[model samples]
Target chain A: GAGVSQSPSNKVTEKGKDVELRCDPISGHTALYWYRQSLGQGLEFLIYFQGNSAPDKSGLPSDRFSAERTGGSVSTLTIQRTQQEDSAVYLCASSPTSGTEAFFGQGTRLTVV
Target chain B: AQRVTQPEKLLSVFKGAPVELKCNYSYSGSPELFWYVQYSRQRLQLLLRHISRESIKGFTADLNKGETSFHLKKPFAQEEDSAMYYCALGGGRGSRLTFGEGTQLTVNP
Candidate 1:
């Protein structure tokens, strides 16, 4: 892809339901990241993936939030038992490598009702 | 831990006026800094990076190690410059970016 791409631009779900957000990073990019943005808030770091090494999951807010990147190209973020607090925009970004400027996706607006 | 802080939540400026959006960071080591912008109905995009030392859309940011700041500035503001701006920091072994609370810049004609 020319830039970072995300799927299902908008999602509405009931509390306790599970939701999945997908990201397709630019070709040959080795670093991918996921972030959350709440209304009137900053971007919250979630997780990061670089190559096949262990992902840095320190930013995940809770056990219900998890993410996985397959073959270092496509990634998926899964939220289990979503809560009202989960209603926000989920953004994904990719950089050619670490310590470089990253390109972002349009983001998926997840609404937990 | 690395952190980014944008002090102002909202900034209003008139067209042709000088504008400055303050940003500060706290990091133990040398870090990469960047400014990202989000316009109405548009995706977030990178406006400038410290390492690049380049200006985009008439915006420039200088990373000051002594002050631990990366403030975005422009000599003259324009109506199109109205948007949400974020300051981000990246360092350590991970590729994740730590962002500051964004500032919404509104330029009036």
Candidate 2:
């Protein structure tokens, strides 16, 4: 079965520019997540979506960070006016539901220059 | 707030030697703990969860409420066991996880 897929394996953009990272969860998976991994750091939870439930966005570092999942399958994380601090690997994951083993993507390395 | 701490940034053990990766966590209530592993060039994956109370690939972990710890252990480490290990805490009904900085294990054969 296909696991979580993230597009744009790597991205380099200027500061203040907007960037959108995409994620495709496994077929039938109802839970999706976005996380950030800085250099030599742990995974920072960003957002979560489970079924038709309200998504959890408390982990977003700032208002510039936002995400939306359409049709409960594909998700996109948008960073408005990206900062150099946003340079990190963006990871996406999906599971059958909360508490299940979540499958992760290879991650998209975003570099805000 | 929930947090997981992996004190050791790196661990090295010879093949066939015992290995233990320390993990400590803090949460006000009953917490769910997990171990996630990522090999070089591979995606991160779940290694085990404390609730399952099951061993995978000769590795096991026991959650200690008294100590607020969930350390991973293996009787004899193998070369293939070398990888980055992350301690995570799953919180609330959403199951969002708080992770540690991760420890890179090196099994020298």
Candidate 3:
């Protein structure tokens, strides 16, 4: 079976620019999540989506970060006015449901210069 | 707030030697504990969960409520086991995971 997939394996952008990272979850997966991994740091949860419910944005670092999952499938993480501190690996994951083990994507390495 | 803690930033052991990766967590309620592993060039994946009570790749972890820990252990380490290991905690119905800083395990053969 196909696993979760993310686009733009690596991205380099100047500070103050905006970038969008895509994620395609495995078929039939109803839950999606986004996280960020900084050097030598743990995975920082960003947002979560389950079915048609409102997404959980508690972990989002700031108002500039947002995400959307359409048709209960594809998801996109957008960072507005990127900062050098935002440089990190953006990871996406999906699960059969809220409590199941999650399957992750290769991640998009975002670099802000 | 829920949190997962991996005290050691790195662990090294020779092949066939015993291995233990300590993980402690703090949460207000009952939490689900998990161990996730990421091999070089590979995506992060689940190694084991405390609920399953099963070992994967010769690794096992026990959930201790008294100590609030879920430590991964292997009787015999393998060179292939060299990778980054993260301990995670899931609480609430949404099942969002809080991860630890991670431990880089280097198994020497």
Every model's TM-score on chain B: 0.97, 0.96, 0.97
Cα TM-score of candidate 2? 0.87
Docking class of 2: medium
Please give, for residues A1-113, the per-residue lDDT of candidate 1 as tens digits.
67889999999999999999999999998999999989877788899888888999988999999999998899999999999999999999998887567899999999999
By DockQ, rank the candidates, best first.
1, 3, 2
Global lDDT for candidate 3?
0.91
- Tell how far residue A93 is off in model 3, in angstroms: 0.5
Q: Candidate 2's residue-wise lDDT over A6-63, tens digit each?
A: 9989999999999999999999988888999888776788998998999999889999
Top DockQ hit: 1
lDDT of 1 at A62: 100
Which candidate has the top score in TM-score?
1
Q: List the residue pairs that clash in candidate 2.
A: none
Off by over 4 Å in 1: B92-95
Ranking by TM-score: 1, 3, 2
For model 2, the stretches where C-alpha displacement exceeds 4 angstroms are: B28-30
Which candidate would rank higher by lDDT, 1 or 2?
1
Each candidate's lDDT (Cα)?
A: 0.92, 0.90, 0.91
